[model samples]
Target: MNSSVEKCHMFHESAVDLLTSIDFCESTLKTSIFFVAFNPIFWNIISRLEYYTHFLTKLTRNPRTGCYVLAVTIFSLGLVRNYFFEQALYKQGVTGVLQNEVAKVLGVALIIIGQVLVLTSMYQLGIIGTYCGDYFGILMKERVSAFPFNICENPMYRGSTLSFLGISLLQGKSAGLLITFFVHMVYEIALKFEEPFTMKIYRNPKKD
Candidate 1:
């Protein structure tokens, strides 16, 4: 009974917040509805946790799969998060997020560069490469030796971080900045766990 009451209270509080931020929430709600209504069967087919985990394991067991999962989730959700945040900020009349025209320009430049770096990394890695195949014990045939790979070991992760920070700076939204910080935290955590595993995977390519 008490647990039920607590859940009710939380719902009530969230409703109140929604009421206060009606316009922003409405836009957010609409976007969510659209995505759900169009639920891409293709993504659902591939993005299942079970299949991804298996796929991640094949390439290397050193923890690359988990890190890949984290990266893909962050990149995909970051796009949604930033979109909602921008709408909220606009509705709230929060302007100072962009210090000035010059700042906005610089922010846009950063966003573009960051996006290119991120996409390049993703392309080089491919879907499973970006996500992970360890659950299936399926590893990439070989290491990626491409432009971005040569330029930086983890270009995608670094670019993604830059993209979020850039968007936050461009919009001058403190909320966006906070979310970006959270993202960075997740990535950092993944890095701590994944890097050593990756090194091991590279060092000892054959498990059997």
Candidate 2:
């Protein structure tokens, strides 16, 4: 127990040190972080609002169409966030520890694995499932429990977080790493809200 406590404490201190190395005040970095924080928050709020009000469904005149609209908006936002993250990486200082050839190789491997997980998840879920189609009253026939889902719960979120870390390492940027950490944190918080709400959605007797 003492050893576990010590390890946790050490990890916390190391994280603090890593964060201190980043330039939080830089415009690009701040913008990227804002989007990183904003994307999940925006999606969650919109999804829940749709659940409660069905305003999007009413606007589109169809559930699937509403989900598709949200999916396109989310996808476009992601592209913009990625662009800012790349721009921030260019402006940030490189960490010496991540400059080695081994880091580059590991980074490539991580990116490949992350993409596989993400792509496989998307393929399994489809666009509706990938986004918040269930919130639009369009749920899966049953719970998905294949391949990536069997191997990893919330595979898309996990895969995205891994990809962020992989890119940070590839770039050797402290700011990228810091932003990746924030991305992971935001996902975790989003999940806290998402999981229970998703369960509630599926609890309706109409589901297959």
The prediction achieving the highest lDDT against the true structure is 2
Off by over 4 Å in 2: 1-21, 205-208
lDDT of 2 by residue, 39-87 (tens): 9999999998888888999999998999999999999999999999999
Q: Where does the lowest 10-residue lDDT sum fall in candidate 2?
A: 199-208
Q: Assess every candidate by TM-score.
A: 0.56, 0.88
Clashing pairs in 2: none
lDDT by residue for model 1 over 33-147, one digit each (tens)? 3432232222333434434344434444645554466456645765565566566445443334245788678778889988888899889887667664532345687888896
Best candidate, TM-score: 2
